[model samples]
Target: MIVASVPRTWFEEAVVVFFDVVRGTRAEAGQVLLPDGRALPGVRLVEGEHLAPGAVYEAEDEDGRRQDPERLRIVERRAGSDPAVRLEHVLGDEGTVTVVEGALQGIERPVAAQLRGSVRGLGRWGSLRRVHGEARVGLRAWWEAAAGRHVSGTPFEARLEHRLAEATVWAVPRPHGAGRWKVRLELSLRGRSFLRPVAAVALLLFRNRLREAFTDRVDRLAQVWNEIVLDTVSQDKSRLRERILDAAASPPEEPLL
Candidate 1:
């Protein structure tokens, strides 16, 4: 079983919201209503619902692979002033595990103290996370600086490195007193570019507005690229087939009046 806890603060809420947006669980039109009445852009939200205990919830992405919701847990409601919610999960006999930790240790340091400020922002909980050599995984995340900055498409050059300091996983045998096998997992990501001055000005002028715009821009940009490439390829393929057919056809040797 795996168990953990996280603060029930705005920052944590932001992370959850971001994931939902990326996963298409929440949409501006159907579910994810902004404080204002305007509709947000990017990916469209299709369906979402929480699972009850003993109930099975399954889903599939574009790849058509079935997903298990029991793998992840969200502590929606809390009882006390602990400020943090605990998370627990069980790894079945034939299950894949991918855990994320070390958000509190400020990411990682590359060369000098230049990376300190952003690292300090994630909070000093830990510095690493990992899993055994049992699965093929991919990590996708969009993070802004604590100073309120845009990390892409702008000219600013400031960088923040999110790295894992250490990671380890252990497996237990059937016998209660049996020994365990363990291995270390290494994960690292650093050097995120940001638009410092422009970001600052935008943040000063419009608080969370900058982050919201950034998210929308990223999503739309991806969608546009996908459409453009698919259209271009389709046109090129049609032209190629037409040319081939014309060349393969035989023409009359004599001209008809």
Candidate 2:
């Protein structure tokens, strides 16, 4: 069994999300939703349940290997400008991640975000979250997941172990310059039982390798974001929508060591 508190006492792995904003700004969020706050033209909302203030949107795109819910959805019919939009990111085969609060604003600039989701494939893991993005302050999250048992699928299917005792990811940002941020991402993971000492040593030994992998992935994501924002200045909703869709369809390349 893995103890929740004092993960430092058990096996732990850490990674950081550090990157520089070269060609983006708080205003770029308008590319998704107009600066005045309206869904781009011809943009359609992903099917989801409607709540009082806002409606939930999920990536129901069923094409290719639709494993993760990294699908695209338009922000439509919300309240005033900068209206809150709920993002439902599909996770694994049967998991949906929802940014229920203080996150729609995050789409444009880093702000306090609360992203929550549940996963149930190899096992039942509820409340997997990445819930904060305050610039000056750091992010904190609590996690508890179940162990996977008898997970069956194709040879490529993963029989993931339900061994993650607890995990937390933090994003800390500082102003680099005009419209630029120096953001650092941190990830901490703890394993349970006999996997503690063994896994910890192995992960710590290759710690730098993990950092490199994280950095490369961040670079790719930043690149995609820049591509959307830096496109030719135009109110063409179709062009903007296409750019957004293209980015989501072609995810960043695999992390290269």
C-alpha positional error of residue 212 in candidate 2 after TM-score superposition, expressed in Å: 1.9
Q: Which pairs of residues collide in candidate 2?
A: 17-185, 69-90, 147-162
Candidate 1 local lDDT, 1-257, one digit each (tens) = 11111112323433333333323322333323332322222112233443212222222333334434323333232222222222323233233333321112111211111111211211243232222222111111111211133333221123223342222222111111212111112222222235445544654777566457655764575466556434433344325333333322323232100
TM-score of 2: 0.38
lDDT of 1: 0.29
Q: Which stretches of candidate 1 lie over 4 Å from their true place?
A: 1-59, 63-65, 68-70, 75-83, 89-93, 96-257
* lDDT (C-alpha) at residue 22 in model 2: 9
Q: Write the per-residue lDDT of candidate 2 for residues 125-176, one digit (tens) a residue.
A: 4533323222222122211111212222211111223344444445434444
- Predicted model with the maximum TM-score: 2
Model 1 lowest lDDT segment of ten: 107-116
- lDDT against the true structure, per candidate, is 0.29, 0.35
